[model samples]
Every structure is written in structure tokens, then in C-alpha cells.
Target chain A: MNVKAMQKKWLELGVEVEETEYAKTGYDFSLTLPAEKVHALAEVMLADGFYLVFVTAVHALPAIEVVYQFALASSPRCRVMARTAVRADGTVPTISDIYQGANWHEREARDFYGVVFAGHPNLVPLILAEEDVDLKPLLKEEKNLKDISALRHLPAEAEPKEEKAPAAAKKEPAATDKKAAKPQASN
Target chain B: MNVDVIEDERQHQFVLNMGPQHPSTHGVLRVLLKMEGEYVLDPQPVLGYVHRCHEKIGEYKPARAFMPNTARMDYLGALIYNQGYAMLLERAAGIEVPRRAEYIRVITSELNRIQSHLLWYGAYLLDLGAFTPIMYAFDDREHILDTLEDICGSRLTYCYCRVGGVCKDIDDKFIERTRAFIERLRGRLPMYEKLVNGNIIVQKRMKSVGNYTPELCARYGVTGPLLRAAGVEYDLRKAEPYSVYSEFDFEVPTEQQGDAWAAFNVRYREIEQSLRIVEQALDKLPEGEVMEAKVPKKLRLPQGDYNCSVEAPRGELSYYLVSDGSDIPYRIKVRTPSYSNLSVVPEVCKGMMIADVVTSMGALDLVIPEIDR
Candidate 1:
């Protein structure tokens, strides 16, 4: 579809596309949306015969943003880009169902930026080991990271109602005591 | 209804892990093969052995300083990756490349691509149990490396490309050598065809094996030989026309079968096309300044994110750079093609024999560090 037609189609899908650009900078066109709406936007891209090239994130201080770049293999072959502002530890629904290529792309994004894909079947570390999932190598600046704890957004710890103090502090240590007691890999 | 979940499909009886230490030029990738006797039920790729955190490093360094580092990603086609980054920064900053450098870039990179395919033809055949062809392939490829090394000052990991243009200009000696080498390699193709293309053993191993339709390749974002073999003529150099690629004339070869043999044929034909491109580029190599003068030492991109893609040897190598209008880029994402191409293994390997897994893997022409990075 032409850019005007595509923009109209996106509007039809309830996507408020930011703008249409024919080869502006690196992307052909770009759309900015909230984190929850990325999956909806991706469906339009998939239906329009776009290929999911890569899913990545940029840690831009106040907000961490995820970028999904797509290329239309159909005639004209215009490139499309989508950017969404994700909260630290924000979850974007998986597109692996639509494009199997997104599975590893999402994993690499999560491994580097700690932005979770809510429904990825096996959301383990891809380039990083399971234990080093939290390090998030790409989050670091020259001297130190801009932020770490907030990188992988988790639910803000509930006010410890006395007895639940230590359990609320960590992800799964005290909660999954049975599995923690079993074993660990030799480092 | 979804793939990978396999609702009522049979479960795999055994799991086999092959290589983080593979002898192929495609670096440290471990494939977990779930097998039932001699057939592969599922093939899962486990990566991240050599993640250098190159993007993180990009954020810490100046844009110009990061040019050389791109070569480390796809070592086999370092020059191609180098051009993609250099041209990206140039486009962002509105820097113009001299016409002469544009011709030179096309010539050298095309040579690098031919050398890369030669290595793949040899290495892939080696994996499929043929050793004699590699000797001829490498012997021809050695001349390309030597020629590039003379002009660029490096062999494998070329840090030759700079922001506005390449680091050095080629003399007539370089031009004469490239033309001679092209003719020599052209003469070698028929012998390669006789030994491998027409051989019954190769046909037994390759024909109708590890097949992927054009639709399957497009679904998983596969490019280069894999896509061409599946009968799509979607070459970025032809479709999008970057650099001097438009000025030169060549064909985008395609095969209808979408099998391993088709992919092999695509790569072989591509070598001939690239040779034609180099000859045309050499014939049209212009005379002018090779570098854009007075380029700013400290580069600052206008605050925006842009993407650029090149037809690399393996597939489409794209660079997505997001700049915060600072000397250091905010993010530099390489959309390396192997990552997507290899992702299709699980989909394609669903019911193939165990040993055919090697044949399929060989056909993908994966370079592991590209995927891992």
C-alpha cells in the first residue's frame, strides 16, 4: 500500500501513527505508541506483508523505549519503524505468534534492556546466561549505569506487612524456597 | 494453532547439543538437536557465547571511533558492514562521498563479497563431506585477501572504511590485479560445477533437502541466497539501489526449488554476478578526490533515529542508529540477517533426519558472532 493508504489503514486499526516519512533518516515511516498497544500495531504491519527485522530498545534516561523495525517486501518495499515508551520492566505482548523471527529478536532485547515480552514461551536469557539476566550490559553509561533496579520493571514491593519483609524484597528466593533448596549450576 | 507449541505433535525422545566449538567460520553457536532415532524432531539454537556488548561500547565512544568496531560483527564481510556504518554516519551528517570513492567502495566490497561466497562454497562443501573443492576455492580467495590487504592494510577484520569515504585510494596496480583475479576466478567456476554441482554424491545430499518456500523465507525475514533460492529477486542493491550499485548492471539470480541445492546454486551464480559488478565498477572508476574535505572530527547527529541497510554477503545488514545530538550515539542496533535466517531452523527442522541437520545448517551460511552480537 502507498504511504497515505497505509496511514489510513493504521488509523482504521486505532493506531495514532506519529508521522509518515518516505526514507527520512533511516526509517521509511515511524509510529510512537504506549507499550500495551505495540502488539495491536504489529498486527497491522504483519497483515500488510511487513517482515519483523529486529526488536531493540534505547535507554533514553527518563524513559526506556523499544524500537521494532519492519521492512515491506512487497512492491515499493518501504521500511517502517515503531517506537513505544515502556516503563522500567514494562511488558509488550509477543508477536512470535505472527512472526516466528520475533522470538529471538525479543529475547535479545530483553537480555540487553530487561524489557520483558509478556507472553514469550521461553523467556530465558539469549546472549546472557540465566544468572546474568539482570546485568543488562547495554544499560551502562561510561562511569556507571543510569539505573539498574528499575531496568527490569517489577511490581513495586508492597509495604512489608511485618512478616512478609524479606520475601517481598527479592523476585523468587523466599517464594520458591523448594526449588531454591534443590541445586544450582557450578559457576 | 501457533508454531513451537506443537499441540498434538509427538515429543522428542533425545536431545543432542552440537558445538560452541564448531570448526566452521560461522562462530560459536550451539544447536540443541532433539532427535527420535536418526531423525531430528526439533532443532533449537542457543547463542551468546561471544557477546562483546558492542552496542554498549558504541554509547561510550565517539561515532568516528566506532567505525572500525563494526567489522568485528561480521568478520567474513567486514568491509560491507564497515560501509554500512560509514554511509549511515555520512547520511546523518549530510556529508557527501566523492564520486571516485563511491566507485571504489562498490568495487572493493563486491570483491569482499565474492571472497566471502568462495569461502562459503568451500566451507559448506567441507561440512557436506567434500574436501578437494576447498583447496581450489581458498587458492582463488587468497588473491582477493592479498589484493584488499594491499589497499586497506588489514586482511580478515578490515577497519578500512572511514566516515566520508574509504581510508585509502587504490592505485592502477590494484585495478590491474582485481581485473586479472576476476578473469582467473571466472575460469574456475566450471571446474567447481563439475566437481560439486554435477556430482551424484552432492545431489544425493542436497537435492530436495532443507527446503523453504519464498513464503516461508519472507515469513521469517530471510534474505540473500536463502531468499533468492526461494525464487524472489528482492536484492536490496537492485530493489533499493544503494551507492554505485545502480550505475552497474547485473542480474539477481533465482531458483524455483527452494532447496539446499538451489541455495548453493544461488551463491554460485551470485559470485559470477559480483564479478561482473567489480569489472563494471573498475571500468567506470572515476577520477576525483577520494575523501570529503574538512569533515568534522567530532560528529554530532541531528537528534533523531534512522536506519540503513546493505546487501551483505550473508544477507541484509542494517544499522539502526539513535542519536541524542551528542558525540556519543544513544543506541546503535545492528539488524544482522543471520539472526532471523537461523531462527527458521526450528520451523524447517521439524521432521528432518539428524545428519541432514548439518546440511541445512551449512545452507544457512550463518556467522555466529553476527547473531550473538
Candidate 2:
């Protein structure tokens, strides 16, 4: 379907959409929806047999814009992007109910940008270490260092470090008394 | 000894740690399998041993710099990943590639598909307890690698394709060599059928095992040979033509049964179809500049989101790139086929023996790096 028909259908469904800008290279439509209607919009799209390609969040200054990209399975080329911005403080409704593929993508977004997806079954860290340490790797270098230090100041008891020998040390040969003496003799 | 054995027998299920290094697991994938006798009760796959955070690295690097890393994700189908990423950018930036460049892209991509299938054939035979087919398949794959290296200047991790077009042009000698190679491969395929495909041992191991119906295949988003094996006449090239594929004539091979044997047959038939595509692309190759002249040194795509899907050897590989009118992409999401294909393993392996899991996974052509990335 063309952009005009898509917008008209979306309007008929009681979902408000505004065409913010036109992109030359990719899909034509840039839609903005109310935060409360995000999940409903995704459900409607899913019922229409649209496939959820991915969910990504861009860190704008005042708000974190979470964009859910979809396309019809029959017409895979026609792309549609639905975006809704949550406050920088982080609160957004989850769409895992609508699309099963969104489960992992939501977890990834949460771990990286700290965007809390409400009602997500599992929001645990997908890639990062258990302890938070500047999860935003793309942040400015100086600010990242500051975030790292701030993370380091958390009470040690809050997050217990696993007690295991370092990987390199685990591979070291056992130090016998004879080997120690031989090392000294060589020196 | 009998008393001690009796005392220790509480009799739950044994947990077997398959590999961080086992050969059959393929590429450092470790699976914790809960076994009840010889059958798997449940299996949990643990990754990240080889994960270098490719997405994070791509985020830091410039758009052009990430082209080489595309090959690293699915080492077997490197050209498809390269094409998918490059095409997404090319479409976004509105860079027009010459006809000659598009033909070369098709030729190399088809060659890469053959190489990938050869590797899969070898690996699948190995999974079924035969070792000779692997050696035979590798011998054929070496020829493809040699041909690609001669033109692209690299063998395994080929960064040959560029944003608008391929990195280099092919000469008459390269074309002649590819034609000779295809002819040679056609002669050897009968030998492959005799040694592996027609063998009774392989048939016993693969036929009627790990059956995935067409409905289940669609539900799981399985594509490429696996979906075709399930009787779905869906190929991205024929369904939604891109990169001058519509110019070529080829058939989408499908099989009746979605069993391991059917998957193998679909891939085998696909190799023949790919050979036909390569021949057509070579004959119809337009003589012109290999790389487009108008493509920019620094690509700044307009602010928008683009999704591009290509038929990788394994399945349909999709790349979603969002640009904010900057040289660097705002968000890049790769929906690799292996992720969905691998997700269906626990379902397929539910009532099968431990050995069937290996064979089924091999037939599915599970590329762990692609999945983990």
C-alpha cells in the first residue's frame, strides 16, 4: 500500500499519525503516535500480518525516541516506521504481547539505553555484565568515563563479584618449589 | 563398588556440557543438554564465548568501515551479508550502480551461495557419521575460494563489494575461469550424489527425521532452503526481485517433505539453479565501469529508516538501518536468519535421539556467529 492509504487507514482506526518528514533513500513515512496507543498500534499492525523487523531507540537530547519498524510479509519492500518518544527518565509500554520477535530486541534496548519496557516478561541484561558500568558505549568518551566511575562507587555489597580466578591465571602452570629454584638459578 | 553405586543413585537426568570446543557443535557453541538416557530432556544453548560485540563495534566505526565486518558474521555466506548491508546504504543514499557492476555482484553472490552449500553438504554428511563427503566438498569449495581471491584480493573474509558497486572489475580470464569451474563442478556433482546422496547410511540417518511442516516453517520464519524443503514456493529473488535478479531466469526448488532428507534435496537442487543464474549473469554481463562514479566518499544518508532483505545461503537475512542525516547510522539492527532457525531447534528435537539433534542442526545450517551477532 502507498503512504497516503496507510495514513488514511491508521486515522480510521482512531490512531493519530502525523507525517513529520520525508526520507529520500528509505521509506517515505515518519509517523508519531501517542505513548498510550503504542501497543495498540503494534497489535493492529500485527493483525494485518505485518512483520516486526526491529525495535531501536535513538537518544535525542530531551527524550529517548523508541522506533518500532514493521513491514508487510507479503510486500517486504514497503517499510513503515512507528515512533514514540519516552521521557529521558525511561518509561515505555512493551510490545512483546503483539510481536514475539520484540522480546529480545526490547531486552537489548533496555540493557543499552536503560529504557524500561513495562510488562516485559524478562528485562534482564542480554549482553552486558551483571554490574552496570556505562552501558551506553556510544556516549562521548569523557562522559562515559564519568559514568564508569559513578558506577564504580556503588556499594560493593549491592552487586557481589563472582569469586573465580582470572582466565589467564587459571591457565598458568603450577609453581613447584623446584621450578621456583630453577627460575632463580636462571636469573 | 556395587554398594557405592547404589548409594549414589538418586536418578534424575544427567546434564551434559557439549562444547566450547567440540567439532560437531561448530564454532565454539556450547549447549547444556539435559539428557534422559539417550534422549534430550531439554537443551539450553549458551553463547558469547566468541561474541566480540559486533554491533557495538559497528556503532563506533564509520559506515564504510563496517563492510568487512559483515563477512565475519556469517563466514559461509559473507557475500550476502556484504550485499545486504551495502544495498541498504546504496538505496538510502540513492547511489546508482552500473549494469556491469550489478551483473558482477550477481555472479559473485551466486558463487558464494554455491560455496556455502558445499560447506553445508560436507558438514551435514559429517553430522551423519560420514567423513569422505566433507573432503570431497572441501576440494570443490577450494576452487570457489581461489576464483574469488584472484579477483577480490582476499580469500575468506572478502570485503570485495562497495556501497555503490563491487571493489574491482573482472577480466575475460576471470570470466573464462569461472565458466570452466562451473563446468568442472557439473561433472563432479554426479560423484557427490554417488558417494553421499545415494548412500544407504546417509538415507537412514536423514530420511523421515526432523520433519518440519509448512505451517510450522512459516510460523518460525524459516526461509531459504529449509522453508523451501517444507514446500513453500517463496524465494526472495523470485518473490521480490532486487539487484537485477529479475533479469535472470531460474527456478525456486522445493521439496514435498520437510524432513532432513528433503532439506538436503532442496539445497542440492538449488546449487544447480544457482549455476544456471551464474551462467545467465555472465552471458548478459554489460561492459561498463565496475564501480559507480557518482557515489560519495562520505555517505550521509537522509534521516529515515530502511530495511533490506537478501536471500543468504542459510535463509532470508534482513538488515534494518536507521540514519539521522549523519555519516554514522543512528541505529543498525541485523535480523539474521540463523536466530529464528536456531530458535526452532528445541521444538524439532523434542522427541528425537541425541544424534538426530546434530544432524537436524547441520541440515538447518546453523551459523552460530551469525546468530550470536
Candidate 3:
């Protein structure tokens, strides 16, 4: 399916899908969804001729935001980014079964921020030693962490006005772990 | 004394370790091989030997301070890495590079690409037990290094690129030397084609070895010459057209076989195509300042995430920068090409001869530092 059709499919999945300016964001489309739907999104992306570009995470207030980027390999290239926050238990579903390349990426993410990929076949440390897995070197000190709202540079046309507030408030109570997201700042 | 052997449940199956030191495995990469005699049952590439946490370093340093770290990731294609990071920050901060600076980036990056390919050509042949071709390849590559060294002022791991533009400008002598080096390298290609590509032993070893389908490559997210060799024709330079590459007329050379031979031919032809781009960029070289004058001394990116990808020699080298309006990046995820390129090892090396494993891995151009970083 083309981009429009794919956008409709994602909208049907009951997630917030926003198209952004490629010049500014370097991504044609961006979506924010719950962590559970990422596996389904990965399946749809793979079927739509999109390849996994990279998988990374950002440690922000209220959530550890897991990010996945996909790009169309062919022409009229469209780049898509899907982000989901880590669950309260610090686990997210693995897309390794969907995209084999994600296996390594997920492993690297786990090595850095300690966000576990629940179903990854080999979730061993990819860039760190076995003993150093618990180091979680990329995790920021509490004073240095930023709010999720402050980091997303969404385009003006697609920016949501007040919907983000309630969603973030609900995200705060469940995630109070140290290595995961800190408590939500007052909205 | 008891010997601990890692034996598979199947009869006569044993595990072998290949390098963090072995020559054929290249640059500090270890492959855990599940072998049954000569055939590899599985080749699991164990990485992280040289992992310096380059991305973690990106978080600690200021935006401009991280420039040198980019080159350290892939020393062979250092300039391309520099260009990727520089363009990424430029895009984030809305810094416009000069017209002449873009042309200079194109010329130098393509030259870096050719040097990377030349080294891969020689090193790959050495992995296949050919001694003489490396000498010829390095002899040709030295001219490229000299030309680049004149303007960039470093042989390898060059920190030439800055946030908005290059650190230094190229003079008339640099241009003349680059032109001469381009001509010299162009003359050497045909002989390489005749020497390596036409050899029957090389063909016998390379052809039909490590064959992967386009769909398989896409599934694995493989890019660069390996993907192009599979007939995908998906080059970031052609597909995305970053750094004034759209103006240059050159082909993304491809081969249909999807084997080591095909990858070899694709990279081989890529050298010629890079030379074409360098020549075109040099001819169309604009007259202007190389550095943008108005860039802020204290570089602070707006609050957001910015990502940009450029075609490195191994594949798509991308930087995902997340800034919280700080001079220091909150997080920077480096998506190095070799990491993904080598991820397909277990699937590709299974049931293949042990000797062909080296050829296949060599064909992928595994840079351990880049992968580990």
C-alpha cells in the first residue's frame, strides 16, 4: 500500500499518526502509540516494504521512550518513526521476529538503558560485557533528565494542543522505577 | 585435567572460535562457529570488543566536540562519517552550509569512499590468499590519502568537518592535486578489473558463494553494496540525495548475482562512479567561503529530535540526535551501517564452507569499530 493507505491503516489502529515536514524533522511521518502496539506496527511496516532503520530509546521524565525508525528502500522515499514508552515493568515487545535486524538493535538498547525486549531470542549485551550489563551507562542523572514534552519537536501543523497532558499524567503513576522514567512533573 | 568442549546435540558437531585476533575475521571481531567438519552450522558474530560507547560519548560532549568521535567510528570512511554528523547538526540547528562547502564535501566524501573501497578490495583479496593485489590497491589508494591529507591535514580519523562547514578551506593546489589523483586512480581501475575480476580462481571462490536474495537482504535491513549487489538499486545518494549529490550524474552500480562476486563487482564499479562524482564536483566547484560565518560559538540545538542519514562506504550511516535545548546532546544514537550489515552473518554463513565464510564476511566489509561503536 502507498503512504495514504498506510496512514489510514495506522489511524484505524487507534493511535496518534501525524505527518511532519521532511525538511525539519527528517521524517515524513511520526506516530506515538502504546508499547503493546509496536509489534503490530512492525508487522505492518515490514509488509509495506519498509525496512527497520534503527531502534533506540530516550530516558525522559515519566517514561523511557523507545523509538524505532523505518524507511522505504525504494524511490519517493518515505521515512517513518514510531515511538512507544517502556511499560511499568521496563519491558517492550520485540520486533526481532518481524525484522531480523532489530534483534541486534534491541540488544544494544537493552545494554545501554536496560529496557528489556520481552521476546527477543538473544537479548544478551551487544555492546557491553556480561558483567557490565547492569551498568546502564546511557541512563542520565536525575538532575539532567528532560521532560518528554520538551524533547519532541513536532511540526506546528500536526502538534496536539491539550491531548498530551492527560496522556502524560496517566503515564506517570505506573512508572516510578529508578532506571526507568522518573516521576512525572506537575502538568 | 578436563577439557570443556561445546558440543551440539547432533553427532560430530563442535564449536570453534574465530578471532578477536584471527586475520580473516578482520579487526577484532569474533565469530562463534558451530561447525560440523568444514561446513559451518552457525556463525554467530560476537561483537563489542572495541565498543567505546561512541553514542554515550556523544551525550557527554558538546555538539561540536563530538566531531572527532564520528571519525573514530569508521576510520576507513572517516570523512563520510564527519559529513553525516556535521549535516545532522546543521539540519537540527538550521545552519546553512555554503554552496562551495557542499561541493567540497561531495568531492572529499567521494574520494574517501574510493579510498575505503580500494582498501576493502585489497584486504578482501588478501583474505582470499592473493598477495599482489593489495600492493596495487594500496599504491592507488596512497594517492587519494595524499590528496586528502593536503587539505584535511590528517592521514586517518580526520576531524576536518565542523558543525556548519569544514574546519579548513581547500586551495588551488589542493584542487590541482585532487584532479591529478582522480586521473591517476581512473587509469588504475581497468588493470584491477583485468587482474582480479577476470581471474578464474577468484571467480570460482566468489561466484555463487554467500548468495542472498533481495527480499532476504531487505528482511535483514542490509544496505550499501551488498543490497545493491542483490539488484535492489537502493542507494541513499540516489534515493535521498544528501550533500548536493543530486546534481552529480553517476550511476548506482548494481549486480544481479547477490553473491560475493556480485558485491565485489558492485564496489569495484563504485570506485569508478565515485571518481565520476569527484570530477563533476570539482568541475562545478563554486567560488565562495567554505565555512558559514554566522554560526554561533556555543552551539545549542532547539528542543527536539533530529536525524539525518548519509551513504557511508559500508552502508547508511545515520545519526539520531535528541537535544533538550542544551549544548550537550541529551542522547545521540549512531546507526552505523556495519552493525546491520554484519547482523546477517548467522543466516548467510550457515551450511557454507568455512573458507567461503571469510569471503562472504569480507564481501560485507565488516568494520568492527564501526559495528561495536
When only chain A is evaluated, what TM-score does every model earn?
Answer: 0.69, 0.64, 0.85
Which candidate leads in lDDT? 3
Per-residue lDDT tens digits for candidate 2, residues B281-354, read: 99998988989888888887754456677889988887776554557765576778877676566567765677
The TM-scores, one per candidate, come to 0.89, 0.81, 0.94
TM-score winner? 3
Tell me which residue pairs clash in candidate 1.
A26-B306, A26-B307, A88-A153, A89-A153
Return the top candidate by DockQ.
3
- For candidate 3, the per-residue lDDT at A85 reads 84
lDDT of 3 by residue, B1-373 (tens): 0112344467898799999999987799999998887778878998899998788888888998999999999999999999999998899889999989999998899999998999999999999999999999999889889888988999998998887788888999988988998888777778887888999999998988877777777677899999999998899999988889999999999889899999999999999999999999989999989999999999988767888999999998889999877789999999999999999998888778789889889999988899998
Q: Which residue ranges in model 2 land beyond 4 Å of their true spot?
A: A1-13, A16-48, A71-80, A86-99, A128-187, B1-11, B211-219
Cand. 1: chain B TM-score: 0.96
Models sorted by DockQ, best on top: 3, 1, 2
Judged by whole-model lDDT over C-alpha atoms, candidate 2 comes out at: 0.71
Residue B225 shift from truth in candidate 2, angstroms: 2.1
Summing lDDT over every window of 10 consecutive residues in candidate 1 chain B, give the lowest-scoring window: B1-10
**Could you give the DockQ of candidate 2?**
0.11
lDDT of 1 at A34: 62
Candidate 1 lDDT over residue span A1-187, tens digit each: 6778888887776554554443447666666566667778777777777777788887643445677888876445688777665533456678777777888888887878777777888778888988896776676453442321222212235431223322112321122232222212222
Question: Model 1 over residues B89-125: C-alpha lDDT tens digits?
Answer: 9877778899999988899899999999999999999
